[model samples]
Target: MARLVRAALRSNEYGFALETPRAIVVDEGYERYGVTAEIASVIADGAFYYLDAPVKRMGAMNVPVPFSPPLEDMTVPTATSVVEVAKALCGRL
Candidate 1:
């Protein structure tokens, strides 16, 4: 992992961006917004040629997660979902 990051750092012509390939980004916020969105945008603009498929992000739903367990379960990404997404990305599912 460190090696990959180091190589990414070196290949980053933009100075701050870390280019990666077939990256799976997961967060606690909206998948299409915030930090995930920023990374996705950067990859799309810079390292897209390295990707075999479009980037996929897993995160909480559009609605705010509540304190209630039931509501949070519906809003947040589950471990199963993450695994499924990863499998789908790798063409395993």
Candidate 2:
């Protein structure tokens, strides 16, 4: 539907529609490999009409996880980052 605001898929998809003009799919996988990437790719490849804007994918930074506590925190996606991305996708950022 046109009014579909947002959707997030983690493990499995059960009759979910990827035809929202402004939907944001957040990938919460912290590791290098996650199933969400596959789901996002599948949705993005076939549902172009529903994707008015490019889907935003957020995950761990493209670097090795740091050992220091503070650095580790910076390497992974934080609550603020999620909120910011969500707001951006919703055109509120």
Candidate 3:
């Protein structure tokens, strides 16, 4: 997802991937996934915002993060989901 977002930013020359004002708003996913401090800092300074309609990212269903590959496949989002989130953020959805 980061790759795709970066690609879009590169292609459009948008300020979506730079770290300036430091206002990163991830999809509320980091906490659940145990994202690192470095990653959080980068996202905060670089990305600054998310692209999901949920505003707060997806909610925790109280279910564990899947370990099985197939379960993970069902639980985690796909590239298409990321794209849709981006589109929604861009107001193109």
> How well does each candidate superpose onto the true structure, as a TM-score?
0.69, 0.61, 0.41
lDDT of the candidates, in the order given: 0.69, 0.58, 0.46
- Candidate with the greatest lDDT versus the true structure: 1
**Cα shift from native, residue 37, model 1 (Å):** 0.7
lDDT (Cα, tens digit) per residue for candidate 3, span 1-93: 556545544564436444232222334244344433334444443444542222223322336777797775656556666667656665687
Model 2 lDDT tens row, 1-93:
211211433232422344345545555455335544555566666555656576566676768778898987787677888788878877886
Clashing pairs in 2: none
What clash pairs does model 3 have?
19-45, 24-48, 25-48
Model 2 misplaced regions, further than 4 Å: 1-20, 28-36
What are the runs in model 1 whose C-alpha is more than 4 Å off? Answer: 1-20
List clash counts for every candidate, in order: 0, 0, 3
What is the Cα-based TM-score of model 1? Answer: 0.69
Q: State the displacement of the C-alpha of residue 56, model 2, in Å, after optimal TM-score superposition.
A: 0.7
Q: How far is candidate 3 from the true structure (C-alpha RMSD, Å)?
A: 8.3
